[model samples]
Target: MSVDRFCETMCIATIAVMFGCVACITIKTPVGAISGIQETLTVDGRPYRMSTFLGIPFAESTAGENRFKKPITKAPFLSTFDATKNPMACFPSHLGGEIKYGKYVNFSEDCLNLNVFVPHSFEKNVSLPVMIWIYGGSFVEGATAIFPGEGISAFGDVIVVTVSYRLGMFGFIQSADGKLPGNLGLWDQHLGIKWVHDNIQAFTGNPNDVTVFGESAGGASVIFQSLYPGNRGFFQRVIAQSGSALAYWAVHATPNAEPLIAKKGCERAPDPVKCLRALTPRQLQDDDTSAWQPVIDRDFLLASPQEIIFGNSSHTQNARNFFASLDLMTGANNFDGAVYFRDVWPFIFKTTDMNTFNLTRGQFTGIAIPSIIADAIKPKNHNIASIMGKLLDFEYTDWQLPNDSATLLFSLTNMSNDVGFFYPVVSTVKGHSSLRKGKTYLYELSAVPTTHTLQTPNWIQGSNHADDIQYVFGYPLYAGPRSTGNYTEEERRLARGMVTMWTNFAKSGDPNQPEDARRFTNATWAEYDLNSQSFLHFTNQGALPGSRFEARRMQLWLDLIPTIALMETPQAHGTGTVHVPEIIIGK
Candidate 1:
């Protein structure tokens, strides 16, 4: 039977099963028949009917013996599966006092499901572009429930799929031996993408046209997925927002699995994986204090992301060539640094309120700068770390207003922004653009939301980390349960423009192509090159094209600091410690 006829028959069968009492849609996928629910979404004054297939298992449950191992593809179902309700989130790992997206409730190790949202207007013969979303919660906490794709799917005219993967110890735990190789989370994501590529055609999605996009750690995952030699044809384009694989926190050279294993009384076991598997999920999750991140397993990652993306060795060249084959779009927010200050100086500041926070010149010079340098740079040599810190202190200090607390706060925020978000994102674009193969576009989100959710200090001036997510997903038009506040008309227009640009990129390699989409902004987004460094600066007003975002700051971090660190030696500092200059408060 034809695909359209088959879909019609399946929908009829579903209606017959319910005695025509309920509205439902069913599609006969390669694996089995799945039933979905139809919903109405209103954009502007028009209501669009959307088909939502939720909680479809892409892979088998990673419980019991499957723990810490690569996810296996889920077997076919015997009967029509219900894809109406949201799936359970993977067990979340606790981050001490870190404000993440949602509370962990109704979680399980069997949470390897994905959700599909399609426009109801699409027929089975219509081939729509597919955009898969991978969420970010610092690789610890995130759920498909929090990120509803109905808005994007209905508005963008594309098939949207949100994927859920294993998290924390359940996903990234590794053994000292190779028995429990890490990166199970990445493997799960791979399987999810594969399942979508194979079965999306049944839902009127083009298998060959796919774009994978994500934020923060999810952004880093998009890069990693593109870097994998095996994923050449899995995706054609990638959009990484506010995250890069080269960031210090993105990949862990040495995973601290011993401490967690010892805490669980599995340190002395004959087989660590077996011992850990024997424990209950609660026992394993409650005591997992270690920061579980992706390790450089020889299979997934041959070397560090830095080595693969920046190194000139033959092996790295092959990886870079593969990465360059896909169209890339990446960037970060303007004030992304504000989020890291709580952890960077936990001793000095207990809260994000700058009015209550106090700092002296001595502390800023002697302690704060050094602490941030150590955290951001992670220099191998102690002398290099000290030198970089001293240089950064000199670069960031506002000499004219040395005693002003607001100035100090602004300076610190700038320093943190460069180290955490700006530098890494710029570096990623540079690496991709240098190859001169596939198209690369860069952007910086400078629009501060009027409706605030994060506890950003009043002194901070620009968008905080993850702030751009709302506009990208058209959240202003359709705010779900996690709505921060009511958005303004301007914000709604920005959301419409953002959705258009993002969907445009997914459909074609360029964000400006097909020029007939509702034009909210007159400014054209320029392609990023190494020399020009052109980027789109997103603001509440609209997108404005600019060149060399933070040109001076980029030079300081990318060129000057590294050069100084390389040239300086122990003798330069004398006594193995650099002496910090005293700055009187009144002076």
Candidate 2:
């Protein structure tokens, strides 16, 4: 027999003898020889001792007829499948934008794989809570393989799962009739959770105690899944870091399906769906033109987020179950808006690469203000706009410090952050606290860890968008955290605290209630509600009781801007409508 074949046969025989039962187990013999199965795992000679199963397929191929359709769960493996390596990520998707930082990654369509992590001593009867991680890339990028789950599983004594899903046009190209359901990416995540629920017991996980968590777009996707009626009981708790379903960029209000289909040459076909099926994945991804995003597909989302969350739903509000029993822990960074305005500062506003994209000053003015107010206040048929520009200038521009260069830049960044991130986070906290009987905890990440790579000025301290991901995942993780060319003891200290709080929330409904949780060693994170608007401000010291300063800052967008426009309605333009009252800050 060939040596390779002999080794494989022996490996299979060992596996059969050691794992005769359904539950996973590996036996080591006394002769200093590994027994009948795949043997031990280690990070050097010393072992963290976690049983890691990587690149396990969770769903069937999303190619051919499966394109733009819901995920179909894969059949059980008939033999030993090597899960030590990661599967190819969904095609044409960037691996967490690593390319921007001079890193390359594998990409392909057959990428619906999941990684499972459990303590080495884990037994099926021990039912540890499960935490499933979803990554963020504006629905365009990210993968599960980049994140390690073993350390977290060992740290919290819980099962950790990192999931991969379809991204870009492959997952979000919508169909006008809802026949080709566009939430394939979401459905992929849903199937992953369901798979874990059904099969995690074999690996020593409590299917009933699952928590979904992520940062940036991943955080927003958490809210999307929770609010949807289909995912009501899928997860027991949530940790949304630096993102929300209500964030302007989290979920787009419009559908870009028709344009996408047109790009695929299906606009004139008798059956558009059939034409879409004929094209290859590369055809859909080429030219990078697809505006793939979540839309108000009546199936997944019966109505828009505004209608459902803001009490304008078609059904009685009481009939809906919005986090009725689920606990929530969500928050954003202090300078969350810095990256939003990194390029467009000092009066240039915005520019485009395409020559046809040029707009005159008046037209550009409308684009500068919050999108909700721009069109409503813009003068029509004049090929120009002014009212909103003047209003925002009056509101955000610093007359007292007009000469300072960074003042206007900082002002715009703050406005963008509040409009897109902070306002929505606070709104979600308030909504859950008011609607649900379970505990709701909120936090703000302000630690400037030495690992942040985005080159912002020193003044822009506190955390920027998605900075908490590094701290929570650990600075010296298996693959190493994205560092900022330096290290400090205090930053690593902050990381431990963040990870503890997150895992505590996953293990128990309330983070602070988790007995002996590393975070609770210092403070009691108070529940956020309408009364105090309390939050935990996470710094090097620890999670501390912090008063919200956003109430006044958000007033500029939710009150002053809209109210002033209402007061000056006719003077700016007779076409201005009062329909924007819905944008008012929730009380």
Candidate 3:
């Protein structure tokens, strides 16, 4: 939906914590009055402050027959529910009008609502550490009021939030006989991270020091909310930048909700979820969102993320109760495969405004190999789709960009950004570094976004998808040519070293500590084990953080992509060579 204005930009950065407001100070909030303002955040050049709080109602008003069910949270109101505007953007309806920031947004279906901020010099018996953003439109068009949260809650003191769920197909649907229990858009992001872990400690925050981050389908909904056992105490650490939960469009469902509620006329009606919850949200935003999203539910996607990443859970007992020791930092974005290379740019110049740049390689392999082998479920060989288009044209045949149709549009935009976001964020950091019970970190962002919005011409270079959200939320300060609207001493030293390494990994799960590692290194960003694949590489020519000794073409897309890897366990399948597939199907 609006990844920095469709891979471009128009400058909209504010949200670095708020801490104060000159006058409007009304407090009391189980569900009401939340006046605020006063924000800043310069870090390493100094300027702190925090307290923002806008549009607060953690839940309630899901609108009409509670629009397909499950998120209630906002109840006890008494009036003054103003919280100073900016909260409605949930009915994206699968991006009709391609949804570019929907006229600076306000769309609603009573949009769940959330936005907290906090920082101004703590105290009230101190409690900080909290961060919760979850934006990414493949869950059918994002919204958390387009994330801004005041410079990482005043340059990393902490307590920052951003939420709002339910998208395309009104937050995913189901019912071939499942009485309608699809993942209510992941239970509206698990009731907005359980209403901020039961009311973010009245805004001082520290509900077991929460952390839940996101990007691209909100980083696969922070690995499906760290694979719920009913989300133990809401959150405790996860960052998943590019995206994961083994993407092939992160677990698509669709067992047939009768041709998706018969595109909203309510198929064979008689209460098709109350005749598709009384239509009009522009007729469910224009239907066909390929049967909405995320399924396989016995209650919130119960199994098969290859049986919850290979512990093969039929139901709890094993699989470490769905691995929740939870310390994760996941990564992505080396041109996050240029968001599927801006729709194959006229199929790599073979042109289509009614033909002509010359099209052939068997007509772009008969239009991109039968739509990437009918969107996944391959490997039963029989020349698995010409051996996956010659193993992705033999590792994305690059002949150095700028010609041959931008090198076949940079090898089909890094094979659709390496099977949708770097082979599922390096197979979800090799299944949470083979779960020792949490402790994993890895990165790779490759900067260079001095504004782009998919202009798609000048040989397209670094940083693509969601160009590192204004250097991880401190915003525009890349102030070089003494540019007035600021930010450019190398984008203010990479937004004060990525908002102090994402608020020192949400206040200590280790982000190379020592005040976010004294402006980037004396070393220590390790922990991505299975032996030194130690990454950190966040560059725009700053370089340095780079040791990556593993990549036999990412071991042939994690041993021959049975739909983007991740389900390899069994003590790492005897050091990889393929052979690993118990179950994997299609979208």
- Count of backbone clashes, every candidate in sequence: 0, 3, 22
Q: What tens digits encode model 2's per-residue C-alpha lDDT throughout 223-269?
A: 87777766655678888888887666655455566776786789899
Q: Write the per-residue lDDT of candidate 3 for residues 200-268, one digit (tens) a residue.
A: 777778889899888887888778878776787677788988887677677665554666677566777
- Per-model TM values vs. the true structure: 0.90, 0.81, 0.34
CA error at residue 64 for candidate 2, angstroms: 0.8
Between candidates 2 and 3, the one scoring higher on lDDT is 3
Over 4 Å off, model 2: 1-47, 92-105, 123-125, 286-290, 312-319, 341-367, 370-391, 453-459, 477-486, 515-521, 558-587
Report the C-alpha lDDT of model 1 over 169-271, residue by residue, as the tens digit: 8777666677778888889888999999999999999989999999988998888888887777778999999987777667766655777878889889998
Residue 254 of model 3, lDDT score: 58
Q: When superposed on Cα atoms, how far off is each prediction in RMSD?
A: 6.3, 7.3, 22.4
Quote model 3's TM-score. Answer: 0.34
Order the candidate numbers by lDDT, best to worst. Answer: 1, 3, 2
Top candidate on TM-score is 1
